[model samples]
Target: MTRPELKTDPKYDDYDYPTTAPEVQSGHPGHTTPEQDAQVFQLRTQLEQAGYKERLDTLCMLRFLRARKFNVDLAKQMFIDCEKWRKEFGVDDLVRNFDYKEKPQVFEYYTQYYHKTDKDGRPVYIEQLGKIDLAAMYKITTGERMLQNLVVEYEKLADPRLPACSRKSGQLLETCCTIMDLKGVGITKVSSVYGYVKQASAISQNYYPERLGKFYLINAPWGFSSVFGVVKGFLDPVTVQKIHVLGSNYQTELDKQVPKENLPKIFGGTCDCKGGCALSDEGPWQDPEWKKPPKWEQPSKTSQPTTTTTAPAPQAASNAGTQAEIKGAQQAPMGS
Candidate 1:
């Protein structure tokens, strides 16, 4: 398909797109035109003038701009709200201090993790919704703890994971490829956990915009059609377009984007790690050749933990793409 025209300047028209994967276009990182760069600059200037101290990185400003469709005003408001929420939520403190000792138990009931890279070199994040046991999960952790974990994972995703993937693939990686397995999920189970899902979705969309790369709702039951139809109403068109809703026959399509060697065996791929792919935390970020400690790592504390799962006692957590919003479907949130 011909790319839509992007206003460009002779100086910035040489922006490179990845050769190994499909070209990332206008709305994402690594593909900005002159106008987009100006927009980011304007946003940065406004934020700085407004007294915002951090999160003014060019990539981040671009993300917020893309999320708001490049509307500087709306992007500014969103950025302001996100910063306020960050402080109120104590995100910086949680990233450094919060630990989820019950991570092992939590994973047993609700599986979420980064296993490996997709064919395009973006990290593959997998979640199993059909297996959720909210009651059991809550026994070991509260909803607040889960939110903290989500924030922590988002931070890790932005750092070690994406940077490592970018270095390994020789490209700039900004989003994630998500696979949400829904084999046994039914309305009753969904209803029981809707509240938590809503809260989670809000945090992801409101705080972490533009992180979805590819989304696959695999093993989707027949009943999910109506549910998804309703869910679709709540998501943006760009996000809805990125989602692939599939039933049991998801293997063929999944294999096209994620290599069988990299995919977990349970998902119709050849991979089955020593423990389990859900908890493996395997990816380019873990490769000694490319891996580096996250900037957030503290000298005194060696191990890093995340919301979905924690690092081993002696270790730290490691760290995708799409223009998709990841809203309403990809994340465990009943809704972003």
Candidate 2:
């Protein structure tokens, strides 16, 4: 007797860029087991029965399932709660219209931005927390606005950024490689930022799950171990495994994960954008060949088609173009 055949998405074969075989075979969309496939279908049905009108795609469902360790009931509840939170948070409206007009001002005090991709073609998001001045940042923009901007950025990542990276790298990229700088962070600073950090961590772990690919905490100061002990309570074991705690001598390890040419100079890399890495928002997502309007901005069927450059199909098992997960911007570690 033959064993069951692994599932695969045929569309990926013809995509302009190839989907990495590993991603397909790692229990994701293209290579799910029969049982896992059944779970996805069941979750979708339950969601539809419960009146979830959006984000019912296979990839979206799988992320929630993985977050809950593939427990269908738990995944269903997670999806329901996420949908409810999206409604209450006015996520749709925020995605379409919310803009961080004070982004520059906020960046001056607390830097959090996506710069480029890492070795595995995942986007590299950098957060400079050592110098964060919550008091000064709050004066420019309230914590409420900061969180709103975080959500908007996450939405963009799911659509244009990840899709563009997948197309450019010939692979399906969903998560991000993060660098959390902790050079100047101290106990006093940690306490000062605890409130915002807690709120941000809750949002990332609860609403957006399984978006973290690699996490690095560099320039860890003394007494970081004790702080990390408390921080671990907020993160699950899988997420904790993804994290790497590095001391001031982090350049070598960081370079091993991220190519020096793509890394920022501050992190002992050579890349220095004309303006600054934080504000540049530079990546394949902005590349003319790959960038396009996000899913939310796409014209409706009633609207006439316009001539414009189009991006290749995002070949994941997605129907509504819905995908988003982020532990981004949270940068929640022992310090800062």
Candidate 3:
């Protein structure tokens, strides 16, 4: 038979699909144990089979404390890597996820972390609704001139108003998490939090808030201090009443915007209803408190500890336990 003619246009070769594994599997004896590529998944299974449950948990803690998200694969791989790191000599606190829960909350799983500093004059660290970059971690691990410089750069990116865990502006972020999905835009900023609610809300109004509902107060009360850092007793009930009245009938609009799975439950306080609290007891700030509204546990935390240190303790204290050794070395003779 004549050999298959080679096409000069090369469509057949270009259209070719290559396979590293066979398409068929058979239970017949002596199949020669498949091939090397066929055993590719074996390493993952072995790593899983090795099963360092505690080690894995610790890794999850590492990611959490360092502002990492947790998922099953990560929990497992972190366990393996932590063990490997210990064997290689970088041992200690293989887990410390900045929290105390077995599984992180969904909001915790999907929020932002700030690495921003390009537009600042002071050191700040901010977290909100987003992700963190473990590979670029500058706290301490690698020892290089560039890595050293990064620490200085990060200091400027920090925000005085933000928290390490970063609080939301209100239920606004929870709203975005719910509404944006209906429009098909996935929020990816690690710095997204309550602080950005206005910006996101503005975007929603022009782009998708019509699907959500009316924005109750359009940039009200003038300053963020008007919301946070103030006593609930001092809050003006009327201002809140107006906002509630403005967006009161939001459900009909929500039904149109959200996919059924993303439907928001009627939040008594954090509810998507801009109308005020859904618990008939409160109609607006008129109910006497957004501070500890009904159906919510834990009152609002409007202030931070006055004594909390904004920056890491001074270098002298940072090396507290090792201070004696460090001082002795400095005093040692050059030749001795």
Candidate 4:
């Protein structure tokens, strides 16, 4: 099957948003190659034959294929295992019916939140591992409940977060920008939560492949590098490459990728939203005024008629023309 093309709208010409190409960029950490694409097609065909096609889309199939490096058989098995887990876990019902009434209380001890978007239009997820008091956390919510909440959040990321981002940027966004803050962390803390972290990592790596675009590990305490060196052994090289381990001096580096206004003040930024940055959930995707129309409703430039007067010009010139038209339209009539 040929790769699908993303539809672009001329109406969005003046919008200053990052654009991603339709096909996955090869050699990129989270992207798939042509060989992988072919394998994805083969896997999809097989899944369709087996009546599992409805459970996966091209993006979803490509994730499994990429997770196993385009090994069709292995990818298929991985996907099958994931489906089995989903059924047993009651993921669909959880997504619809599960509610964490203790979320606010949980957040007080363990910070896990989808705050905003990064420069690339991917959602920004922050998790302060050092703040985790598992004993206190479990007092309010069980381990099973926490995992359920994680799964629900993952579902939201796949749906509204990514789709909204795709609409806003006019591109296919499939991953998130993550900040795993390890401030005040030590060997004891790491060891204490190793099991839970390992389980969460396995779920993300196995079931939700290619969903991490950039990972920043800030406030690395003493000996954290050596500790990470041991941990990295269990992770894929691609996954390791996407992670940036930084010391307390992370502001300058983080500022390069994330806008100061969008970042939380606690993490060395300017913004301090009403409730809090972590829960503010502020971004183009979340803004009612800036949100893009759904994919099916968005008018593609190619589908619309182009007249001599309305033909698209060079990008810079088109933007200038659009601005001028808007300025003229908005200007009040002069008094005679």
In model 2, which runs have C-alpha deviations exceeding 4 angstroms?
Answer: 1-26, 226-237, 299-336
lDDT, residue 208, candidate 2: 72
> Scored by CA lDDT, what does every candidate get?
0.73, 0.70, 0.22, 0.63
My TM-score estimates for the predictions, one after another, are 0.82, 0.82, 0.17, 0.76
Error of 4 at 310 (Å): 60
- Tens digits of per-residue lDDT, candidate 1, 46-91, equal 7766766566766678888988788888888778777768777877
Off by over 4 Å in 1: 1-24, 226-234, 298-329, 333-336
- The CA-based lDDT of model 1 is what? 0.73
At residue 209, candidate 2 shows an lDDT of 69
Clashing pairs in 4: none
Model 1 scores a TM of 0.82
Q: Specify the highest-lDDT model's number.
A: 1
Task: Report the C-alpha displacement of residue 280, candidate 3, in angstroms.
Answer: 19
Model 4 over residues 128-157: C-alpha lDDT tens digits?
767778889888988878777777777767
lDDT of 3: 0.22
Candidate 3 lDDT by residue in tens digits, 1-336: 432221212211221111111112221111113332123223234343554222121112222222112233443343344344333431122111112121123223322111111111111111121232223322322223222222221221111111111121121110111111111112343233323233332222211111111112111123422543343233233212212211234445434332332222431112343432211111112222222222112232222123432322212111122222212111110000
Instruction: For model 4, give the 10-residue run with minimal summed lDDT.
Output: 327-336
